[model samples]
Target: MPEPEDSATLYAELLDSARRLSFDLRDCQTGTDDADRYGMTPEWSPLYGTPTWIRMSEPERRRLTRREVTHFLGVAIWLEIALQIVLLRRNHSADPTRPDVKFLFNECADENLHSLMFVGAIEQLGERHSPLDRVMILMGWVFRTFAWEEVAYGIVLAGEEVFDVMQRDWSIDDRVAPAVRRSSHVHVVEESRHMSFARQKMRDRLRGVSRVRRYVSAVLIAFGAHIIAKGLINKGVYRGLGLDWQVARTEIGRNEHHRMMFRRATAPLVEFLDREGLLNGLARSIYRKSNLL
Candidate 1:
């Protein structure tokens, strides 16, 4: 692919975005004594509107929400670790004088802080790991080592964009816990810049790339997105709430409301990827199975 047109200008814009959007992690504090409350709206809950949800007592639902939110935060940490590794690998040899390199380093710093925040949130809510966590970590290692530049960045972009949608929602809803809302607000504000950078990077890397690579990237990105979406709500969450794990998972999968939420959250990303020729037939099928199409 050809070099970024006027890299200096692109660098300047990214640097300015980083500067203007940075947030201090220390500012994410809750004044309420019951700060460990549920982190999102009941409507945003995974099993919301399901028959199981209707049958669940209020306390059961609230406990599930808290645990599910913690699992989601754990997912954030998982994604951030992969993202930081790929980003650092991508730009490690970049010219320090370039604005893009500086911006990338800044992003790594932001992600580091974000990871710490997520860990704190998870600890506060009680950490719960998915059964797939170990496998996902191995996948992250493979991705950082072998995935094509555009594909790696595309994967990163997919996670950030999808999570940004949820965080944007959580940040504004008054029903969410204050500390959780603050974290979501910070993430939405900072990830907007990361998303911009990742999109442009994907565009640059895709320029003049071979068709086979594009097709492979499309499938891989979709597959990665599938894992992410499924792993967001762990079975442990249901077990913790005294529900049958398989039944809860099945109900969540079949829940039209929950499926619609995924579709809506991923719509912008789907549009952008399709416009860029990264959402091919195979990718669309994969997204459909994940309820993101």
Candidate 2:
């Protein structure tokens, strides 16, 4: 935990960073050679090293990558929209003059821009994917409606951290499409500020909170993480690629490599949650079941 003075200084720095940054969607336009490139890092693909993956032809693999990336973008779009609503709710009673409230508004604007970028990326890929299932949609409404304080910020941090780790790889990998790389690079740069703001808010909110409330927040956050990890790739992706969806699901379930990647991506979040006393047994179980531990 930061001292009061240190925390205030950090908040000022984060707000300044947010105010200084801007991203233009036009800058992420696809290039001529981008069509021939992968949409994300090949290693991050859920089935990357599986026997089925090894048997896939180049075109099949490329199509799978496109679908997977689009799926990720779609999920990101959903999360960003939810986050915007959550921020707006937070801002409803907040003083606009405060630096924290100002940062929240800035983050909402950033999230709106990010959603547009994700939509454009999907359009560029030209892949048709189904929206998230009804259950997840309902869950999202519940979260954005009722989640507050540490719970809300913890969910935001989880999504941003997971995507940040993956996008960092996609942004620098030469094999990824230029548009994907550019959009990812932009997201990584902007979301770093959002993540920091969320961490600071979570710490502030959790300070001197009750044990029961903390435990409840921890479980809710874990469930939120589960929803995010589970929703990233749609089941329709495998079927779209002309593979057996059932088999692909089974393989993904047992794919230690993909599980390891998930664990690696979420390592920082897990560590932070633990330090904040939000990593109780129930939370750990949920994270483990979701392949996020």
Q: Give candidate 1's error at residue 40 in angstroms.
A: 1.4
Query: On residues 1-293, what C-alpha lDDT tens digit does candidate 2 reach at each position?
Result: 23476667777888788767778695556533356678799999999999999999877777789889998888888888888888787678867767777777788888888888887787787777666867788989999899987888898789888999999999999988777888899999999888888888888888888999999999999999999898875777888777898899999999999999999999999999999899999999999999998
User: The CA-based lDDT of model 2 is what?
Assistant: 0.85
Tell how far residue 203 is off in model 1, in angstroms: 0.4
Clashes of 1: 0
Worst 10 residues of 2 by lDDT: 26-35
Candidate 1 C-alpha error for residue 244, in Å: 0.8
Evaluated with TM-score, which candidate comes out highest? 2
Q: lDDT per prediction?
A: 0.79, 0.85
- lDDT of candidate 1 over 1-293, digit per residue (tens): 23566655775787887887688775455233244456676777889989898988776776777777877887788788887777677677777766777778888889889988776666555536445566576777788788777777787777787788888888888767666777898899888888888888788878888999889999999988887887776776778767898998889878999989889889989999999999999999999998889
TM-score, one value per model? 0.92, 0.94
At residue 57, candidate 1 shows an lDDT of: 79
lDDT of model 2 at position 213:
97
